[model samples]
Target: MGFSRRVGPPIVSAAVATLVLTNFAMVLLAERASHDGHLFASIWPIALTSTVAVVLVMSFLFRSIVEMGAELERREAEAQHQALHDQLTGLANRALLEDRLEQALCRYRRSGEQLALLILDLDRFKQVNDTLGHTAGDDMVRIVAERLRALLRDSDTVARIGGDEFAIIQARPRGEADVRSLCERIIETVGEPYRLGEREARVGVSIGAVFAGPDIATATDLLRKADITMYRAKAAGRHCFRIFTEAMDADVQRRDQIETILRAELAAGGGPELHFQPVIGGDGKIASVEGLMRWDQAVVGPIAPAEIVPVAEECGLIEQLGYNLVRQACALARRFPDLSISINLSPVQFRTMDFPAVLRRLVEGEGVPCSQLELEVTEQLFIDHGPLCEPALQALREAGFRICLDDFGTGYSSLSCLRRFPVDKVKLDHSFVDLAARDQSIALIRAAVTLGHAMNMEVIAEGISCEAEEQIALEAGCDGLQGHLYARAMPADQLQAWLAEAGKARISDAA
Candidate 1:
């Protein structure tokens, strides 16, 4: 249309000019013929013939120009359409969706109709990308987009906002029920299996929804609120939808606060402290001490590891935190030459390609022998991270550091991990110790101990909080015991004093 508007006038003017020039020439010829005494009938006929021929030629030229303009307009329209739509899925792009959302809001304002915006993010989408490559990931996105479009009304707008994310503008929804039912349908459709070439891919969507009301003023606000709601759904669990709520906003604010505080504390070099929990050998001596992080905030007081660790991981502070703890633990271990130190490894740390080198540098700088340092990793590392974790673990083992599989028997592939990795010790999770009174639990623990021994690995029963639990662990033939029944995690000075007393006790018993 734009092209035609710009070029149509010039073509029409050229045709008109040619016709006018032909008319003027005919008039001149008639005058000359009259002056030369030619017959008026013959002159008139010649003039008429010339005028008709010029008019026909002009008409043909005009029609050709009009057709050219029309073709240009058609191509321009196709280009515009392509620009506003996703090339992969043919869904509306963000720009088009935003424009449509604004239009929808305007209609709602005039007619008092309700409009709902839903933002969806696919769950575990990265797994597909990591495992199957981006081509498969694109295929999955295309499949999901088709499913979403099929589930929506013609009046509704579904868009691919970005990778693994989509948005929908639902026009004139009846109420919450209507919005929720649409969301449910979208989730169900997306949850269905998709065949990407030879592989079967599956993923679920988390949806956040917001409706036009007193709170929503523009497309941006609607989209932001819906996004917040969608994250809440993800937190609740994927394959679900959540409506925007005031409480969710508060939770987001609190998390932001926590992350800010953590960053500030770490920057100031006054973050979580490293404490040691004694891991006693079966012969009743402190064989090694496990380093535990303790965060005592001035505002929140003492935070649990469960709460603090996730915050660190989410905010990308886990690697620094883990490294700092390891360095400090190594420095502290130097104070007691015979005491080996164990520190927990976060999955974030293992994900780093240079984590082994980083650990070596920290230990070497602290003047602690690598053999005296034990790195503990949960079974989830193998299950969640898979092959990416192998090189880091292997590198650390090659550096002369012992690797302990923490919370063993808690994961599905624990035995596989044992077979694949060079693990020095296996720490039985507390659940088994708690349920040791049951015959089956004891049998499981005993089997784990026997397997550990057969593999030439030490087996430690953790969370031995009672004498009965200790006795059960001993009976199960665990090489070590660790829990509150022995001693709580203590500060450096306290742990040092306790280690001295235990050493003396061992020497006296030998004497």
Candidate 2:
């Protein structure tokens, strides 16, 4: 490769001709033709050396450029690979899966075929991380991903879209049965124990499956459907899956409407309608009133107490609702100046820190006497007896706040509760008072009153109706009673009018 010619002399014709010219120049200058042969040969050698050097440098430069380009390409490829995949499980990430799903959706849309999306989330994963440590949890996640991959076909895509969250796109699922079958397989696969290091861990999955076709408009809608189904799967029980249904959508809509209204009510200074159920004394005196809260929306008819109360507790609105109701009742009492008002407090309120201080502040600010304000707590409000409840009750009682057990005999340790709590009165649950005349019921009522008297607490029997029940409660040592027998829940104006009537009756008797 260095030379492709046969050299006949010191140089080829071009180099020799250059030498001949140099020699002729010497002759023409009247110099001897014997001019130095060494110098002539040297001229040809220098030119040849220059050509070879240039070629060698260019060859080295070309090799360096090739190696540099290859190194850059490798880095870019590695980054691209990492971006599309999960680092821990080596599974495709949500982004890549979404892209692929969009492609498949487009194909299905054109072909008019059925496609399915399944999203699965681990149940109580936080518990696993808390009890077993994150290392074990991580290993379990990897094991789950691997097992899920094993259950799927090559055409299907399984991705770890989030932490302890996995998703699958089953292209052309046969039907609901196919989707259910895959769900079962996934559950069983993940349900198996994972051995990571010395720890054996177990976790369950809740899966939501959506069946749709070209009619599916958006990937967002598909995700929402799957997520809602996943929650349903959770509500049903873990380690299971549910198909998307219209009923579920309605349930979700109902919940959303409730949430929106609740937020609005709390923000807009309360649209809550307060109803007062009369708590009449044994002798028909207007004893006091129990405040009940009801909500009726423009779209949602009369909201049930069962629905609102639990939802409020779950959303941490119970504290606000309870406080607001208490404040409202206090304001109403200021109007009468003598009427006592009772506000029902849920267990959630008793457990909240600073609740007592907050309640006291509201009462004192409204100029409502603790005697005129009765704090009605349920039978089991003191469970666990956390400091939050302990000081609140004692402090309220010390401030002359009347404490009453709202639903007696409904929880364990009912007898002990009368003795233990700083309650001033015990309200026999409606169930017992509703039929107190019966043998067993009458005995229980009598026994409850005896217990209340022994604990030095007043007994207020609720749900009284007949004259017989009223006489029985009076004999049982119950100091007060409530029900339709004496008075029913009425409007504020009606209650005031009744109070005025009772006042006149008392004055006429004195005369």
Candidate 3:
């Protein structure tokens, strides 16, 4: 409407000039016909002057109208583009990407050229922002977009669809080189670190690609396939791209179903409940049991805890799960005087501000020695912030809780890391214990023991099954053992019976 009004003045001026020009042309012709006298001379001069003025006005008016319209059209186009694009990156938004994708699919059916889309998410963007404020984060996004744009051809399109998410669409990528080259270029470009205010921040892109020529009919199907591949790319350890596959989609669907069930179970009062795995004493007695949360769906038999526990963590239900599990474990931790029950800590829990105080209150309120209650945490936790892991561990330690490094060999564990991290016990990964000797498992165990002894931490062997495995672990300098052969994980209600059996066996052995 604004443009329509702005154009009105130019159109009217053009029309007026055209009318005046026609009148002047007639006057000039009439003057040419008149021969002599003052009237002829005066009329001819006036007509000549009028004719020149009319021609000049008409030419100027015509040019102005054309120029205004073109400028208006260009302005409108730019405005529309800005509305659908991310401001910082000038990439099409999620909404525009989906709309254009549907159109692309329709066009692909008419001409059998391939249409492919790659979804890219910036890895560690949150970490960068958290460590170095939002200003640096914004600069990183701009830098990444510039690098990504350099990798693309004029025919291809790249869009910023999320905070750190980007979408690239190739209208007709028939050649293998076209597709591979584009992906490779993007990978190389995004892998470079952008020097944002002297931080040398590196932003890696994880891309999930999908191809739909004439085969795919539905937009949802195409997007779902791409999304599944993106999840696979993220899971396969980030900083790379993965092409979509049928199996990946199936795995995604299965996981979605599992997530649905897990949420349902949580809604229905957190299903099947928890069990405890006993951590034996230095003298081979029922010491403390580590709490293990399990799930048994009505339709599925005994769902593995590892699967749903992560789902809980991903869905922000981890805090709730942790609180509930810790409460239950603490309640039981109160019962056994000679025993100290341990709880597994999630990485999210370690980042919470009030976690340490909450833990302190739980231990103090229950009159349990915090040292008796060991916290089993994975080695991967150290990859994050020093400040984040600090308050939680320190508060627990100060409150007399002993922290154990759970799953020792599974993550970025070095000799230096072992010494630097404050820990009371080291639980050798069950992988090494399961094999024992064939695969240098004993050597690794010995090294871990040496490291633990050097650091003054108690060494515990996880899943020590046979007599030979237990003896091997002992000789490797393990202080305690746990496995199916020792005793299976049991509910708190059954802990009394297990304790009685363990106590009787201990008495008999002593005799």
Candidate 4:
């Protein structure tokens, strides 16, 4: 607009002057060629009048053109702004954020002032999206965005990098303390409940922060490291913040290596080997054995069960890996036909509708009886999937496979879980077993055991590593007990030999 106001009038004036000069020059030439000065005088006045009229019309047209140009310039500016910002949140988009981060890096290179980059992922927002409509989800996002804007300085850049993911750039942060304060505030602010129309929703945030220093000189490195740390915060259990560390990078790399090896192993029709730990019955006989998956990679040494599940799930191999373990457990059931073979199930396995059907087919195909196979699921499965898990569980039960609630007392609403689900058994968590001597612990376990019996469900005490723990569990009326006191997890052949030896001891005692 300013350009048009300053330059438009000058261009219009130059054109009008050029037109008048040309008319005057033409009239003069005609007068000189014909030697008619009076004719020149008459024609000059008419030509000047026509030139004035033309200038009036042309000036109006030029003014309109200039105005159109200005409007177009304004529209272009708006388009650029829209391109660089998130349409929904109206915050800076990833492109603009990256650009600003690059500029900040340049400034840091010159001044050596510290800056912080934070990446946040909203936890449990998916539940809102799944249970409510997307409209509710959008409202939640807007609320979070507005809260973030109110919390931070104007100079800080907030970007919606992905759905349910946000990034922040704190240029000229006071120090690490400043960064920590900002992250803490963000988590607290965002974790507050949101109201969307008639319904209320809640979400938590996991934040990963990195400071610009000697190691983090580029935008990409900063973002990547912060993202890695953000996942660490999530793994540490959401609603917390984790600062970037070199060790985190190493762990991520190792996990990547494990994922690659697992992919290769699965593709080749192989996976983690199965080991069985015996669960002894009250009569001092082997009643059941829970199958535990073990991984001993030559390169990465031994991967813990906790580590294996996350890597497999991240790589989309959890179901396959889980099914493989089930098949192996079923095969072992054939060797010890009378012993119950229990296998752990990840919550991811219950996602599909065909999970129960798939398991039935696998076990039946291996010529194993469904009654001898027990499916162990954590209470988290119920909490996460809720009633949605009922159909599959019922189908498994109707098909003669038992459902045992693993880590029973460690979750919410234990009593309600027993009443709601068709759980055939309960495994008291090790934490309770360790504290069995306490009067409160004994009462809780005894109550749990009595409740299970009333529901016609078997109660098992797990993680009993000593005689004192075993006696406490027995006094609590637990029907079955399993832990290091009985036997550690062993390979299939070793377990078979152990079973054979135990049978002979029983026969000798009977004689």
Candidate 5:
């Protein structure tokens, strides 16, 4: 049997005692034979032979036990090593990295040496995983980990903290310059191309760095600061590095406050109002009004849709916000029998299979005609979540709702999209409207309008801010127009008055 440290000494002592007792017994037998005159020579030879046999057996048994114990220790050491390291890349994991970070912080506190943490996230990694197989993705991750280890100093620690996020700890750096140089090196190294099976793949990393300072007191704080800084680097543009700053913290705080206020507003049913902008038809009459979401906070006055809508989408409030806007639009449509209302739908709202059914129920409950309700979708919905979204969109279309492809000319495959989906209307993006005076731009706009009409779809020109642009759109054969030139989006009550005033102006001009 293999013996542990605590039991080995006792077992050895017992074996030695047993061997001594056997020798003593053999001596006693020889002595007794000599005293009884039974021939001492014969007895002495027999006793020696028996003692030799016992010694040989004990030696083999002890050797076997020692070998068994050594094998057990070897297996245990291997298990411990595997626990601390990543199995695929042989790099330290988050647990081991955190432990080392804690140690480094302690050393810094005692010696006042500089320590830095870098958090790296690979850009567009999901695209690689989605396009290539996950096996290739795993291979790519392993290659990245190897490259990171090769680039860093032996004193530094590198770890894979998430699927696409890696972290590094610099135990001792010369100064901020040295840390920055190291970060730049890491970016360059990780940005290199890799071979995955028969194809070559490319990716870049965004890094966030933070040095040990008075503000940082724990590993969690260090990591959080680094992550925030990394996001800033990502925002600035990928394939870059950013050092942590106090201003970044302030920005994060402001964002959190905005989200909190938005949530509170949504919960209290006082979130925002839907303002309608009228879409003028070819004959110069209001055909429909697009519902635009507006929010004016007590602290931040008016928050633009460009700013607040993204925040809502990020915080998972887009679905609820979308539903509320649809409800309000339905109510407005009921009030205005002559005009249809268009509501923009976020891509995030179509993640669930029941979205179509839920929207249908909401419209039916509001007693709004299906023909008077239009849902505007951006091109990104088809590009990003095509499979999950197509069915929902089809269901909505089959239920008698009009689906308009918004921002039509902005995407690369605008023409292809019209052929792929069953669309009722196409809203020309503002870019074309802004650049309509250019010959090439006009040609493109004219082509888009012609194609849209040929496809049996209505083409609406958006962002007609001036008379020049308005004339250009009308000349380009656009069927409808919507922009600041006519009127900015206003509350339902304000829109009613504007419409009445516009009607009076038209009547006077005719007379």
Candidate 6:
């Protein structure tokens, strides 16, 4: 195309000039020959032949130029389309979507009619990508795009703004109800299974929507608010939608503050500090100490693990946080060689492909025996991850780290998980101990303890806070009891002091 553009014009100009000159020379020759009177008819025939030949050559040259121009036009149109559309899903790209949104916003301001902008992020998309490969993930995304196109009005715009992210512009939304209805349809349609070659994939969408109004002054504002709302939807447990509110802005700002503080804390060498609580064995001795993460920042007062973990996970600091805990546990393990140091594991940490190997390296690097570490995980980890957790758990067990199922019996499939997973202990959820007065609760506790014993696993009752609760747990045949009843969680140095005191008491009794 470049060559033709540069060379074709000059060549065509030269050809035209030559054609004119040749015709003029033939006309002059014919006129001069006609003056001779004897050769007039012959000269006319020769002149007509010369003129026809020149016209034929110029016509072919002009046709070639026209065809080249058409080809260039077609290619330019294609390039423009490609630039404005997603190559994979063929939906509008972010730039085009924003341009359209800005146009819609202008019309909205003029007409005072509401338009809606929605941002959608696919949940579990990464797991699909990691497990099934990008090809299948792409197929799933395209299927989602098709469903979105089908579910919306022809006037609506659907755009693929990022990997596993989409945006929708509802140009003529009647009201908030209309936006909600659209979101519901999108969630239902996109959640349906996608068949990608031999494999089937499933994903859910979290949507955030913002309506055009006084608050939304520009397209960028609308998109930003919609994205924040989408995150709120995800936090509420995906496959749902949330509308923007002033209150949501406050929450987002607070989260941003937390993220900034956390990063600074981590950069300074650590974020959350570890506190240890004793787990008293049935034999009347301290069996192990569970490492509890504590963050008492001056700015936030005291942030619970429940609050910190979600933020860490969202900000891509979960793996780093988990490793921090492991290193702390390892250091503590070295300090108290005889006692196992248990730490809770997040589902995100467990599902990482390199989790087992990385964990082995971290533990070995610290020179702590794997047996001195017990990893606590909620049953929900296995329930959510299923077969993916098996090899990781097996690898950890082979490396001699004990696996404890935290918050046991809360999930419907706890018993099933016990049968399948390589769990060495079950920590009775606090709810059972809290309701120890109920006959059903006592029976369930006893049954859990009995089943655990039958399976040759230890059953530990957590959250015991009173003498009565401890007695109940003991009578229920728990192998261990932990909670405020024994001792509140304390710093590692304080726990060392407590352990030393307990050792002296034991020595006095032996004497």
Q: Which candidate is the best by TM-score?
A: 4
Please give, for residues 262-286, the per-residue lDDT of candidate 6 as tens digits.
Answer: 9898888868989999888877678
Give all candidates' CA lDDT scores: 0.85, 0.77, 0.76, 0.87, 0.85, 0.86
Per-residue accuracy of model 3 over 252-359 as CA lDDT, tens digit each: 666677778767766776654668887665577765678888666777677787776777777777776776777777778777766777888888777678888887
2 or 6, greater by TM-score: 6
Candidate 2, residue 118: the lDDT equals 96
- Count clashing pairs, candidate 3: 2
Per-candidate clash tally: 1, 0, 2, 0, 0, 0
TM-score of each: 0.80, 0.70, 0.77, 0.87, 0.80, 0.75
Question: Against the hidden true structure, what lDDT does model 1 obtain?
Answer: 0.85
What C-alpha lDDT, on a 0 to 100 scale, does residue 402 get in candidate 6?
A: 94
Model 1 misplacement above 4 A: 1-61, 105-112, 122-143, 174-176, 193-206, 210-218, 228-247, 264-268, 298-304, 311-316, 435-441, 497-511
| Model 6 alpha-carbon miss at residue 143, Å | 6.1
lDDT of 5 by residue, 158-218 (tens): 9988898999998789889988999999889989999999999999999999998877788
Model 1: lDDT of residue 49: 77
Candidate 4: residue pairs that collide? none
Q: Where does the lowest 10-residue lDDT sum fall in candidate 2? A: 1-10
Report how far residue 190 has shifted in candidate 2, in Å.
3.5
Better of 1 and 4 by TM-score: 4
Q: Count steric clashes of candidate 1.
A: 1
Better candidate number, 3 or 6, judged by lDDT: 6
Residue 404 of candidate 5: its Cα lDDT? 97
Candidate 4 lDDT score relative to the true structure: 0.87
State each model's C-alpha RMSD to the native. Answer: 4.8, 9.3, 6.0, 3.5, 4.9, 5.7
**Model 4 residue 238 distance off true place after TM-score fit, in angstroms:** 3.8
